[model samples]
Target: MTESGVAAGFLTLVVVMGIGRFLYTPLLPLMLTEYGLRTEQAGFLASLNYVGYLAGAFAAGPLCHRFREFRVLVAGLLISCLTTAATGLSTDFVWVTAARLLAGIASALAFVAVSGLVLLIVARDGRENLTGLYYGGVGGGIVLTGLAALPTARIWGAGGTWILFGAVGATLSGVVLLLLQRHDEPRHSAATPRATLPWHPRFARLVIAYGLEGFGYIITGTFMVAAANATVGPTGAHLAWVVAGCAALPSAFLWSTAARRWGRLKPLVVAFFLQGAGIILPAALNGAAALFAGALLFGATFMGIVTLALSEGASYAPTARARIVGLMTGIYGIGQIVGPALAGYFSARTGTYHIAIFIASATVAAAGGLLIPDAFAHEQARERR
Candidate 1:
């Protein structure tokens, strides 16, 4: 693959997966209105996507040992893209739920498999210099979803808008698929060994932190728009996501650039704390500006965690990296699976989303604390050989 080929393939893969993620909030209110859903009802359906994703996350590892990832990835993207488009065509909540569930599962398969592969591919050259180009998908999709939502907000309702975006994504996937040279992109590094099943103790701690982050980050991200709506009214919801998207555009660059200089663990710890503060701040202040800033912080660091985690796991015994990532991702998926449901439960009790956000902040703070001992001890343990 040419440099341009890598860029195109990586971005399309990320965007296809990211669409499953960013689609919800932009479409949530529309789903609620179109389906006449209760808050919990909507939430349950939304959480179902995570459930499917969790299942997919677990399967990616074993499959990695068996299949070529780019092939699997292309298949996953095609399925997800089709599902997203189909989800749009549905009129009822059940149909939408089914589509989202399938989309989530397919997207997860693509996400975990490609991510595991990308980590392997990038580590080969020692540069991974264009890493930001890969993550740019999140920011790009955020912008795409946000911008797409605006035009359809008045005309087509939620389902129609989802269909539109889904069509766009699916169509783009075909173009991207055609451009990719399947054999060229799959790089099994010479320095790397066959992926093993389990890892040392340090992997467990990192996995826990990732899970907590999944729980913590989504608690706020799930409800950030609602908070913005309550804070500055309707405009705030749009602005909040927009700010998150705008902030995200530069985040991969900023964090990845820093990781190059500062190394992964400490920079990641600081990033986690910053993210925690972001999740907590809007809850405390409960205003438009605060929510916007919080969204920005989240945008800046959210993907950074995954970047660090992927890179960190890659540095482990080469034979163990995929399984390590798979396990850690599964743990994180558990957190995502639980986070929104907990937030919904808390919101129902308190009649405000702030408490949930605060809880999320606490979770992130705790995750950060775990890294303190993890950072130093992990290195010392590695050196004991």
Candidate 2:
């Protein structure tokens, strides 16, 4: 049942986060062409989704506490699937925008709820290492999106492709429900103290660094397919996304394993630097090779970073894991909301993404640099102890 619960968490992420939330990246170029949407408009649309995500993330902790994580997860999954499917029902920019907004909320609810549940389950079983596997679903769903996007768009148009993704999400959600059936909810006694966010310097650094990550990585994530198509054509664009997804698929597990050896901070710092380099590659070089390589690096790091950061955040307040995750996720969502919009504005006006891409790369590198102090502080503290 524990393994089953873990699997359920994985599948839920694939459906809500992968298919419902991220499917937009693969379909963005298609949406642009099909709907006559400009780059700024597209960016605004993406930002709207993140806005909803931010709201949902802020609400997740309280909702979970009031209703239980299991109930929240179920509601989130169903709504996410419905919203994903609804995205196909219209080409009107406003209608699609509304769908994306609702989908974002649903995805965040599911994300927070399932993450807390899975972490609780694994921690209880002394298998917290499997947290990485649960996060692998994000990459798995991305793979499905990359593999399915072009073919389905060709056969069914962008609108129809969205409907198909919705159907797929719904089917996967069903499996998640079955696996999580009658799942035990962690109950707190009335006397148990409420979990509060710590003001530790390390925790603050972690949250700020994650916010920077949200600001930086999202530009590449949102525009990679479009950028690839502009430089290398549709086939190359699809291939690049697929390569990214494949790289991401094993990254969380691999990075967590590395952390178990070298510790989370070093691996995280290294990943931030690597991801910074990746963000600059495709924007700097003009070739399918550069795009593919960038995709590989980006995919390999983002989910791993999430796994590491969340695990570390949990360590700060084990009793308030869900609250911390929600807070971080909400901050991250704020960065996401701003990133694409600004990137789009610069790209559309300059007719190149170079400026925005360079800025994003620098921001991510700064996040890495910020963590160095925290690492040193931790080492000194540990030695003293």
Candidate 3:
């Protein structure tokens, strides 16, 4: 892959997936404090975003085929920026809800578009390993969110912080547009055969495990900072978030390298189990130290899982890049939609996030368990074949 293509892909992820989608996590506490937003309402709003993301993932493949990745990616980024900014325009729950929903759709579009493009490019050059670097943008964006929110929330409140992130996202989007100006976006060729998903048992297993991962990880991703803030104050909470981001930034690259050395399936199984442990740590213990340790594990494993799963999926259907990606992402989105809503309902009633956290951890452990057969038995079977 060319340097510019890599840079553009990285920055696109930073703008959309990082700032547009995940900035909500660090800002959740602020919204709760500023607008008297209830936990259930927050969960609903988050689920709405994932709902839109599900819609967007389903749409991304068709849109890319119809409009090309460049146009779709650019449009998604712009819409993401606008929707993020719109959140600051009103304190009304309805308004913020709409904003978050729209942001989710835009984020999914941009995320899938760029991922397809980058994966296609790297596949041509045997640089599939660089996917780690490409996905690291999300962590980079999360770190920025954590850092910026501290002063911005203190100075102008949650509304101002939202507006500021919107502006920053827009600026970065413009940079991505420029950086990618020379890179050729892939065009679907009429001569190429239409791509279809293979009806393989391994792919089925992967989809189920990935869906479970989506259901399991999002609870911690959405609420870890808030849970920490409640336990250790705002400063410590943000610090924990930053720590997660720091671990996240290198995780994709490191995990990718490990997969290259150790083979993909075993490493993937390890990541899933490690992530399960990470998700439960803070809930099992208390204090800043526990939170930070959990944050490191959470950050380190989530993107690594993404890098491995998506790459593995791509290998399964090389001819249908967008379709396979959209399918996996669409399933993942469903899990995301369900996780927070249930977590919020239970937490709000019981007055602690402990129940939700424990369930999430167990769900992730189950996901890891689902992959063990593939990691061992199936791998040996495939090698024999």
Candidate 4:
């Protein structure tokens, strides 16, 4: 049953995130050519999606407290599947944008609910190491969706591809629902006392660093395929996305292993630095090889950073885990909201994405520096105690 629960959660993430949330990245270039969307308009749509994500993240905590987590997950998956299909039904910009926004909201709800449920299931089974496997579902989705793009595009253009992805998401969601049907409804207990850790500078640094990550990583995630298409061609772009997905698949487990051996803070800091390099590589150098390398690096670390950062945040406020996660998610959502629009604006103004990518790299590198101080501070605090 625990294994089934984990499988259900994994499939839920694959549908909500891989198909509903991130399919946009691989489809953006096609949308530009087929639908005639400007770079800025694409950015606008991405930002709007993030806005919906922010709202959903904020709502998930309260909603889960009030209702069964499985119910919330089902509702989110349903919305995501429907909205994703809806994107294929129209060429109207307003309709497409609305679908993306709603899909984003659904993705967030599903993500939060599924993650919490999976963790609970893992804890119950005493298989904490499997946590990475649960989160790896997102990368699995990325790879599957990326691979689906080519054949889908060949058979049915951009709109057809959207419809196909929607159908796939819907099917997967149904499977997950079936797998989870045996689980009992979750019950809420009395709230625990909040941890009384000092409002240390390290905590603030973590928040800011995470927000910066949100800003830095998203630029490449959003536009890498588009940029690659322009520089190398369609094949190269597809390869880049696939490479990223492949690299991302095992990254969580690898990072988790490193964290256990070296400690979380050091591993996280190194991840930030490596991810910064990944974000800049394609922009700084020419050729398909460079782009692919960048994608690999980016994919390898981005999700790992997410896992590590959230764990760090939870450790800092163990008694208030949900609240802290929500707050950090909200901040991260804000960074996502700002990143694409900012990148699009600069791309439009300069006729290149290089400047925006450079900015993203620098911001990520600075975030790494922020973590260094936090690591040292944490060590000192521990020693003093």
Q: Which candidate number would show the highest lDDT if scored against the true structure?
A: 2
Better of 2 and 3 by lDDT: 2
Supply candidate 4's per-residue lDDT for 361: 96
| TM-score of every candidate relative to the true structure | 0.91, 0.97, 0.96, 0.93
Give lDDT tens digits, candidate 2, residues 1-385: 6788889999998998889988898899889989789999999988889999999999998888877788889999999999998988899988989998999899999999999999998898899788889999999999999998889999999999889988998899899888888467767555555688887888999999999999999998888888788888988888898888999999999999987877787789999999999999988887878888899999999999999988888888888988898999998999899999999999999998889899999999999999987666666446323
How many angstroms is residue 3 displaced in model 1 relative to the true structure, after the best TM-score fit? 3.0
Off by over 4 Å in 4: 182-186, 189-200, 377-385
- Estimate, for each residue in 19-112, the C-alpha lDDT of model 3 and write its tens digit: 8888888889989979779999999998999999999998998788777888889889999999998998789998999999999999999988
Task: Order the candidates by TM-score, highest first.
Answer: 2, 3, 4, 1
lDDT, candidates in the order shown: 0.72, 0.89, 0.87, 0.83
Model 2: pairs clashing at backbone N, Cα or C within 3 Å:
none
**lDDT for model 3, on a 0 to 1 scale?**
0.87
Q: In candidate 1, what are the lDDT values of residues 1-385, reduced to their tens digit?
A: 4454445545675456557667677666666677677667655766777788787788776666567566677777877877877777876778877887887678777776666555555565554756665666777777677666856867987767777777777777776666555425444544545656445676667778889998998766666765566677666687788788778776776778887776777778988999999888777886777888888898888878877776676666565555666677778878887888887777667777877788889899898899878665666445523
**Model 3, residue 364: C-alpha shift (Å):** 0.8
Clashes of 4: 0
- Prediction 3 TM-score vs. true: 0.96
Model 1, position 100, has a per-residue lDDT of: 73
- Which of candidates 2 and 4 is the stronger one according to TM-score? 2
Of candidate 1, the 10-residue stretch with the lowest lDDT total is 181-190
Q: List the residue pairs that clash in candidate 4.
A: none
